[model samples]
Target: MARPIWTGVLSFGLVSIPVGLYTATSAHTLRFHQLQRGTSDRIRNRRVNERTGEEVELDDIVKGFDAGDAYVLVEPDELDEIAPGRSKALEINGFVDLDAIDPIFFDRTYYLGPKSKDYAKVYALLERALAKSNRAGVATFVMRGREYLVALKSEEGILTLHTLHWADEIRDPREEVPDLPGSRVSAGAKEMRMAEQLIDTLAMDWDPEEFHDTYRDKVADLIKAKQAGETVEKAEPAAEATNVIDLTEALRASVERARAKGKQSKGKQSKGEQSKGEERKQRTGEQSRQGKGGKQGRTGRRQGRKESGLSELTKAELYERASAAGIPGRSGMKRDELIKALEQAGRQAA
Candidate 1:
């Protein structure tokens, strides 16, 4: 079992319960050691006195603050002595609606659990009350000789505390961001509609499992490739910025591309499908065919193409035909719906 980093009493109004704080998150970043070039020797860091040119022990070090022309030195024990509640208590000042706290203020999170089973009921009561009321307890606590502003809230039947940054700590984006667009600037009506359509077409439920740290995975692959004396494929260069003149065209193309990608993703989710490489090849062929008077070519093909073979074409390919035919709500349709809609449109055209 994981050990709690801090154990203390959490009090609110007249009620108090002993609690333990446990770290809630961890990073899986790869660690690298410093090494000399063309050598097996490792490089290490040391604490050395800058003026004396000699190494110093950690025990000899004291906290120092530069005040104008001199230094104010203080011992570690002195800092502990002055901390509120001597770093043993977390007192809730008040409760506020959970939505009242801005997301930017939230920092790290910690799981807060009852220290003893005897205090479980009190902990449960507080957690359930906060969840029911959609409120969070605002509190301050001292830990590791430092004070922290935190919010206590119930999450999935347990209490979780999140450290918050002070108001002064948050930087103003207006001052930090350079040459940001102002509210006065407006996009063209056509461009705005196309961009909004693209967003709607690409909308999906939030699933963290579907996302990952691709950079970290690439680093791991690089290490394995180097160990086996193999080279890894390089990533493609980033796309250039769109010109102002091409904004509307870019937005329209983006909407179509997003719709195509959404259909492709849906195809992948089905079982016993073609390999990704084969799927890409087929898509490339379809795109190439469409690029050369695609809408005109689809019209000629639709007249001769068998209706039953419509199922053979991927959802993305069917969507292209639907787009060329100007079928309504085609972007939101499934593969079967696209086939049915396309068949009806083809018959009408005939």
Candidate 2:
């Protein structure tokens, strides 16, 4: 089981509920580490003094403020004293309507659950009350020695806390965007009606699971293929941007494309749902007929191999094939290291 990173009491009105905070999301992207090119040695960073051309130790480092043209160095302990909080507690100052809070303020989200069995009832009560009132508890908390504005809302019968950005952090759009001089109004009622129709036809319920990071998937596939000792080919350059002249014609074409895409998506979704249902029925039927004996033992392995086979093969394939020949974590290796590893593995196999 995943453990909560933080343990604290959530304060609102006269009530305080002890809760544990768990991260609600995580990144799944591949990471790379720096290394020396020729020796396959991991590279290490150093804090260096620019003037002396020498590495500085951690203890020598101090917080500095620019006073005119001079740097005023402050001790670590002194710096900590001036920081937002020595004690980390979410001090909720006021309650606000969830809708009233601007979407721009939200930063990161955390799941807040009862820290102990005793707090469960109060937690549930707070969640239900927030749900019924359509209000979120506004709170202040200190994290990493800094004060943060947080919104506490009920999500699926559990309290979820979201860290908010300060008002000053949000940039004013008006500053960057120019005010239009009321000259670009050429769409007639018929065009407006057609646009609205197109929008309505393409609209669907928001399903987050339906969307994915396509770029991340492609990167993963590329990385995997490169690991397996394959030569990576250069991708085609992107199409150049073109200037549009006829707005009406463009709008018409866009509407047709949107409709076509919507229909295709709907058809795919229906087919997928049907396939899942059929699979479930087949599993049930097999269970009834052969008492678990009909189940395939290597189905998962076979499926994995099939998926790996069909995925795009890249230069990463060489690294992976090298790794299989006793190279470790070729995924973290550089292109040159991968090439060397692949060559060594090939020679050994020969």
Against the unseen true structure, what C-alpha lDDT does each candidate score? 0.81, 0.69
Q: Model 2 — which ten-residue stretch has the worst lDDT? A: 304-313
Tens digit per residue, CA lDDT, model 2, 221-255: 68878899776555789965544455456668768
- Tell me each candidate's TM-score: 0.76, 0.69
State model 1's lDDT: 0.81
Model 1 alpha-carbon drift over 4 Å, by segment: 84-86, 271-350
Report the poorest 10 consecutive residues by lDDT, candidate 1. Answer: 271-280
Clash totals in order: 0, 15
lDDT of 1 by residue, 1-350 (tens): 78999999999998999899999998878899989999989999999999998999999999899998999999999998887474999999999999999999999999999999999999999999999999999999889878899999999999999999999999999999999999998887878888889889888887443344667767877998999999999999999999999988888888889988877766644421333234334434554555545685574344333423566888666776666556787755666788878666655643
Give the lDDT of residue 31 in candidate 2: 82
TM-score (C-alpha) between model 2 and the true structure: 0.69
